[model samples]
Target chain A: MPSTYSRTDLYAEVQQFYARQMQLLDGGAFEAYAETFTEDGEFRHTPGREPARTRAGISAELHEFHKRFDDDPVQRRHWFGMMNLEPQDDDTIRATVYALVVTTRPGGKPAIAPSCVVYDVLVWEDGELFNRSRRVEHDQLFGSAAAAS
Target chain B: MPSTYSRTDLYAEVQQFYARQMQLLDGGAFEAYAETFTEDGEFRHTPGREPARTRAGISAELHEFHKRFDDDPVQRRHWFGMMNLEPQDDDTIRATVYALVVTTRPGGKPAIAPSCVVYDVLVWEDGELFNRSRRVEHDQLFGSAAAAS
Candidate 1:
C-alpha cells in the first residue's frame, strides 16, 4: 500500500530525520552514518560516481568506507541548506540537499568545496524514516589551491 | 494592506526564481543577474571572509567584481540546491540556499566551492514576484574537499 502523509506531517518527520543526520555528521560518527540508511539503500555522491548501485552494494561499500573513516581522527561538519522534499507515491521521497562540507587539519584554515546533491530516499519498512535511495549530485568544486587551474 | 502566500505557493515562487537565476548565471550574464534583485537589491557569495550587511553593498561589490572577472574572461557555473524557504510577514521571506559553485578553465578541470547561504529577502512592494529587498545573508562556508577526507 502507498504511504500517505499530509504535506505538513511529512515535513515534520523529515525535519527530525534531517536533524539527526546533522548530529551524526557533527559527531564524526562514521559507522553511525552508514547505519542511517536501510540495508538496501543507495548513496550516490557525484552524479556519475556510483559507490553503491543496490541495497547490498550500499551496505557493503558504506560499511567499509565508514570503518576506514572512523579509524582516522578527522572531525567533519556538514552544513545543510536549500532542501526540497517532494514525497513519492510509495511512502518514499525525492529530495535535494545543498551541503557545505568542511574538514580541517586538526587546526587549520578550512578548504572550501561547494556541492549540490540530490537524494532519492525511502522510509523504513517498519514505517520509520530511513533512506532507501540517495544520489549525491556534485554540481561544482571550489577553493582548492592544488585543484586550482 | 499586506501580501500573503501559502507555504507551498511561496516555495513554488522561489523555485521559479531560482531556475531563472540559474539560467542567467549559465549564460554569463552578470548584468542580468544584478537585475533579478530590486534596484537596491543584494547579491552575496557565502564563505566570503566578510559579511555583507545591506543591498547597496552587495550590488556595488558585485558590479565591480564582475567587471574584473569580465576582463579575465572566465567560465563559471553555479548549482543551487537544498533551499529552505520560510514565509515572513508582508511578503518578505527568509530563505537559505546551498550553492555548489564551479569555475572552469579552457583545458583545466573545474574547481568546486561548497557554500551555505542564508537570505533574508523582502518581496516586491508593488505586490508582485519581482519585488526585492535590500539585503541578502551568507552565513557560512565549507570546503568540499573535506568531503573526501
Candidate 2:
C-alpha cells in the first residue's frame, strides 16, 4: 500500500513515539520499553562498545545500566527536541534528535548530563511505529572516544 | 479563509517555530527574537511582576536581562518539549510546552536552571505564526510566588 501519511503526520507520530519511549525508560519499565523497538532492534549507546542487539538484549542492558541510580533519589527525565525526520523510499523513516537528560533531586537544583544526538531508524508495523535501530552520539565525547569507533 | 492546515501540520509548524525562536533568543538577537511575536505581545517571565507588553518592551527587557552574562563564559540554551497544541475556533492556537534552560560554562559541567512551563497564544499573520501572549510558569515556584499571581 502506498503511504498515506503526510510529512507533518509523520513528524507528529515520531515525536509522540519518542515521548512515550523515553517515559517508559525513565519509569524503569524495561520490558515495555524494549517492546517499542523491533524484535531484532539494535541500540548503540556507546561508540566504542558493541550495540545491544535484539529486544531481550536491549532490556537487559538497560536494566543493568540503571541499577546504580536505584538507591538514589535522583529522577532522570529525558527531553528531546530539534528533531529532523526523513522518510525513505523503503518504508523506513530516519529521525535525528537532540536529547538532554535532566536529573533532579529532592531539595536540590536540577542538573543536565552531557548532551547527545540520537539517530533512529523507524518502521511501521501493524500501523504502529517501531525503532529498528538507534545510535547515540555524546556531544562531550565527540573527539576522544567517539572517534575511536 | 477557513483553516487548511491539519492538526499534524500545526504541530510541526509550532515545533519549528519554537526551534527558531529559541535560537534567536539564545544567540542574543533580542530584536529579531521580539519580532517573532505580535506587535502588542505580552510576556510574563515572573509570576509576581507585570508582563512586558509590546515588541519594543520585550526587546528592551531581554537586552537588559542578558547583560549580566556578557562578562561570563556561560552559554544558555533553551530546550522545549512535550508540547500540547490546541487550535481555537477563532483562528488562534494555544501551545503549552515544557522549557528547560541549560547553562554551560567553559571547562565546567552543564547545569539546568529552574524548569518552566510556557503557555503561549499564537496567531497567523502574513502567512507566519506569531505569539500574541506568553505566560511562563516556573516549575520550582509552583506554590511559592506563583500562587500570589
Candidate 3:
C-alpha cells in the first residue's frame, strides 16, 4: 500500500520513534524498549552474530547483556544523527543513522563507546511506527570498510 | 506570524537543517557552516561567557579553535538526539537537543567529549531556516543542574 503520510511526516515520525526507543533502552526499560519493535523483530548487534529474534527474546537478551553494568552503573545515552530515510513501495522505510553511545559514570567523565552505523527497517502499524529489523555495524570492527563507506 | 508549515514539516526541516549544519562544521567548512546561522547570530559555547557574535566571528572562532587539530588531526562527529522543537509566536522556533561529540584520532579509539544540551533559536528567512542564537550547556560543567533537567 502506498503511504498516506507526506515525506515530512514520515521523517518526523521516524525521528520521534527512535528518540523514544533509545530513551527506553537507556533508561533500562528493556521490556518497554523491546515493545517498540514488531513481535518478530530481528536485532543484529554485529554483522555475523546471531540475532536476538522476537520482542521477548530481545528484552531477555538486553537484560542479560546489561547485567555486567550492575556492579558499576553508568548512564548510557545513545545519540543519533545524519539519518537518511528512504521509503519503499511496501510501506517500509529504511533508515540509516550514525549512532554514538555516551556512557557517564556517577561523578566520572563521560566515555564514548565504539561508533556505529545502524540500519533499520521501520513499518507503520495502526498509526504507530515500529522497527522490523535493525543491524548495527561498528566502525572499529570494520575499520577500512566503514571508513570507505 | 503563524508558521506556514505543519508540525511535522517543521520538525523534519529542523532535523535536516542540523544534519547539514553539523556536517559542514565537522568537515571544516567553517564559512559554509557559519552561513547556516544569521548574519548577526550569537553562539554561546557555554553559559555566561562572551558569545561568538556574528557569522564572521563564528567562522573565525571556529577556525582558530580547530587549529589545534592540525598537528594531530582527529575526526570529530557531533551526534544529536532527543530534539524538541517549539514554534513561537514571533515566527521563530526554539529547539533543544542532546549532543554528544565523538572524536577519533588516526588508528585510535573514539573518545567522547563532555555531553551537552544545545538550545537554539531559529528563524526562517528567504525560505530557509537559520539559527539566530545557540547556547550550549555541558553536563560535566553544570552537573546537578543538567542531571536535574
- Cα RMSD for candidates in order: 9.4, 6.0, 6.4
TM-score of 3: 0.61
lDDT of 1 by residue, A1-149 (tens): 12464554565566678778768756755456556778766687655465675555654665665575665665656655445566666656766555555665566756534334456575756667777777664444322322456
TM per candidate: 0.53, 0.61, 0.61
Q: Which candidate is the best by DockQ?
A: 3
lDDT per residue (tens digit) for residues A1-149 in model 2? 12687766777788788999999988989999999999999998766678998999999999888888878989899878877676788989887677888889999888778666688999999889999999996655543442366
Candidate 2 lands at a TM-score of 0.61
Docking model 3 quality class: acceptable
Report clashes for each candidate as comma-separated counts.
24, 0, 0
How close to the true structure is residue B137 of candidate 1, measured as C-alpha lDDT?
33
TM-score of the second chain, each candidate in turn, equals 0.65, 0.93, 0.91
| Tens-place lDDT digits, model 3, residues B1-149 | 23477778777788789999999999999999989999999988765678998999999889887888989778999877788676788889887788878889989988778677789999999889999999997766554554567
Per-prediction DockQ comes to: 0.11, 0.18, 0.24
- lDDT at residue A148 of model 2 (Cα atoms): 61
All candidates' lDDT scores? 0.57, 0.82, 0.83
- Residue-pair clash count for candidate 3: 0
DockQ of structure 3: 0.24
**Of the candidates numbered 1 and 2, which has the greater lDDT value?**
2
